[model samples]
Target: MTTHDLPRLRPEVVLGPALRTGPKTVHHIKDESTGCFYRVGPREHFIMGLMDGRHTLQDIGVQYRETYDRTLGPDSWQQMFTLLGRYQLLDGHADAGVLDRFRQAQQDKQAARQGWLRRRWVLLQPDRLCATLAARLGFAFRTGFVVPALALIALLQTIVWTHTTVLAHDASHQRSWAVAVPLLLVLGWLITMLHELAHGVTCRHFGGSVTEIGLSWRFPLLTPYCRTDDIVLFHRRRARVGTAFAGVFVGLLSLAPVTLWWWLTRDGGPGHRIAAALLLFGSAGSLMSLLPFLRSDGYVMLTHALGLVDLRRESYRFWRLRLRRRDPAARDTLRAYPSGDVRAYTLYGIATLAVAVPAYCALMWVWFARLRHWTGPGWAVVVLAAETLVVAGLLLGAARGRRADRQAADA
Candidate 1:
């Protein structure tokens, strides 16, 4: 099917929440705002069981003996539907289609307004911001910027990758040119081009034709990727590996001479030392390009090694598998093609959250704790409460979304 024909999601998938029950199946329903999904068995069971609407949840559970030949043994259905309704899945026992039009209208409004940007960024193949400038600057200017601009550009590189990854990914498919152009400019020109070029050059060197570059989405985030969809053009693992590592490799190799100069000239008087320091930081920036979890070159490298078409989706699928283990009777519907490194992606995700979220909290707690030692307990309590609330809101949004999504899918 053409892209549009391939189940362009109902507005509900975007504005409404989504409940995914399997790899390809998603049940979408309207929430007051945004969207959500669920992959939990208890939540799904509660939802599918209630959507039957034959009886009150309590009654259903009572006759659970009759329906499923098992005993839910309690009035959990009322509680379950109540909670689902609170999450905006079931609305106060109202008419079934009551809010359907309202939700659809909101989605239409959003699409009408936002679709311009989406179409520009996702449907049209546009030149990215940096492509012209980088082409103009050529190798000489790039070499000069390599020393002083690397660190600054390295920071820019991260932002560039974020934008370019999304833009280029879409552009590869003749989509998302508008989004790609702006993001490339915002990210600065040279690094973004380098990033895409890394993909193209590597693919070309590996005997794979670089058909296109554009923006794409990895669920919650956006990135640019090259269309080496013709990967089979080269059979050797090194070709594939090299193509994948090309971007980070370019980042590092581009900064190599400066790094050598810095090392060689470290003790060479005042000017030399300063130049060396700049070179050091610049090289360091190239190194940052290699980190995997933060959507840098490193992450793509891992995707290649694992041979998964999309690492993030596979990662989430793997995470969902853990949730599935909690409910054996419920089916696991998660899907990813060439599902390599699923466990690795799962562990990476877990370790990432474990390290990032708690570390951030603890760091803030300690900083505030020390400040409180001087400012008094009241200030400390206020800060702690504020932090707690922020975290709670984020977590609640996630949980409610997941629950709502599950209920809708089950329905």
Candidate 2:
């Protein structure tokens, strides 16, 4: 606790990739003993590096000032020491209670890893095989090859689009709502794995590592997720954007053949039937995923492309200031962002809202109409009220986010 006392990080702590967290840069620190990652900013990195046990706090602070031309303030020293001690990053000569908590965290992570082995690792062998195959075929993903490949893919997509413009009006779609909806979601999930695979492959091809490629849940809905967080390090914006939209582009392109077959041979086989259903549902998934409002592949792609993080939240703050408030400080805060980010955020916000408004209304109407026969007028009322509540909640969230942005800027 005193400047005379030397502190050291435990041997089991490791640092991973660094990424832009809003305007700040942060690195991913993994506690080897616990198998979990924590994001820490530049100041924390300086503190962690100094905890080599060779230097006392006073010496470390002096070194930090010399190197960074800024004081390692007394308050930050206390806070950082507490954090390191809590995570058992400090040498294990701290309070017994702190070490006990750290031990419990490690035990909990081991338990979770065991559960992952039982459920996820069993299926992970196939995923690893696919990744190996992809890496071997990595040459095919190069821009020169992918450009022609996408041209062929686009032609196939055009064939289906022109032929199946009236697919919604088809007699095959005139079935029980119960059957179609679930089939759509199920098929969408399976097909979108390939989309995620494309992201992983494109990411790997661009010199980034694939950290995860497995099933991930979003509350009540379960879907496959592929992570390429390391893609942020790419110097080229094209590489990052390509990796981001790789999933959506690959998804739609892969389904083009199925869509064409579904359209061509109306009374096709069960494969055709399933493919047609998937094309319908998966198209929705693709469109939704492209929306910059959420953490879709597109969102992450656009964010990293602009060398910023949390663009959606930051964009929302900008909009809130321009549209609602009149805070000069907030205006200055928004202006502090790079001009490229400011322009991109504005354009993205406008495009998202234009598409999202119509999409949200249509989606809600479909839900109400599909369920109205069973639940009747009372049900319609309930659905409308629910929609209103959801919108209200979103507005409240935006307001809270704006306030949080102000607080962060102040800090």
Error of 1 at 66 (Å): 46
The alpha-carbon deviation from the true structure for residue 375 of candidate 2, after best TM-score superposition, in angstroms, is 8.4
Q: Model 1 off-target regions past 4 Å?
A: 1-196, 203-240, 267-273, 329-342, 365-381, 384-411
Error of 2 at 311 (Å): 1.9
Which segments of candidate 2 are over 4 A away from where they belong?
Answer: 1-127, 166-189, 201-222, 227-239, 256-284, 320-332, 362-383, 390-411
For candidate 1, lDDT tens digit of each residue in 77-101? 4565455554444423434454565
Please give the CA lDDT of all the candidate structures: 0.49, 0.67
Error of 2 at 14 (Å): 7.8
Q: Which run of 10 residues does model 2 get worst, by summed lDDT?
A: 114-123
Q: After superposition, how far is residue 58 of candidate 1 from its true place, in Å?
A: 57
Candidate 1, run of 10 with poorest lDDT: 13-22
